[model samples]
Target: MFFFGTFRHSLDDKSRCTLPNCFRDDLGKVVYATKGLDNCLNIYPEETFKVLCEKNAKLNELDSAQRRYQRMFFQTSFKYEVDKSGRITLSKNHLQIAGINKDIVIVGNNDHIEIWDKDIFEKIDALQNEEFESNAQLIAQTYKE
Candidate 1:
């Protein structure tokens, strides 16, 4: 499953955005949204989201610290079914969590798509580059010669 699309749009006051038709056409009729790191949203096809939830749910919950992390991610998950108009109503709280009051980007991420606040996305990307630069050798080492 390969996801490919880029959407730039404004979030309406009701916490809705027009998702790119290209992204929805092939991802099935039902979709979902979930919390993502660095203040962004993770969109998943229904089946994909189910698989993810199952996997996450099965992990041992013995450690309180880790459970907290799990709850943070899992509790924020939301299931959404995109409409024919290619629009989705993101939850108000979800929008706030992602700091996406307006202007946003929906980017393909292979198995999923990410919804991000434009400025925040750029900042995170720049920081990612810096970290990736420092770990280039270590990352390269992980690959077989």
Candidate 2:
């Protein structure tokens, strides 16, 4: 599934955040959350996560880099089911790892969703915006359709 949009939300005292209606509808009851590349949290639908696992499984386990990656990725990943109120409670460790407190920014990243602390996201977004055109051009050149 392709997701597109940026949403702002707040985590309640109980650490529950409401999922965007669009995302909730697309993701159904279950989803996976994991430590992401840029100090954010990545959310994936069950099927998408399964696909990712299948791809990762193909990597050579004998390689040190691959083993290290697997350890980090799997160790930090969690599975969550959306509640009746359309909310998900992030684990304390997950929140701490992502440096998230109250306010958050949820961004759609093609096939998945990314959750970011508002301030951190703003800084990263600024840099991303500055390089967007050049990066887009480079990407286009690298992968011609």
Using TM-score as the measure, the top candidate is: 2
lDDT of 1: 0.82
Clash pairs for candidate 2: none
> How do the residues 24-106 of candidate 1 rate in per-residue lDDT, one tens digit apiece?
77567678888887789988988888898888787668988767777876888887777778788988878888888688988
Candidate 1 worst ten-residue window by lDDT: 21-30
After superposition, candidate 1 runs with Cα above 4 Å error: 129-137
Which residue runs does candidate 2 get wrong by more than 4 Å?
Answer: 143-145
lDDT for each residue of candidate 2 in 30-70, tens digit (9 for 90 to 100): 99998998899999999999998888778788999998888
- How much lDDT does candidate 2 score? 0.92
lDDT for position 102 in model 1: 85
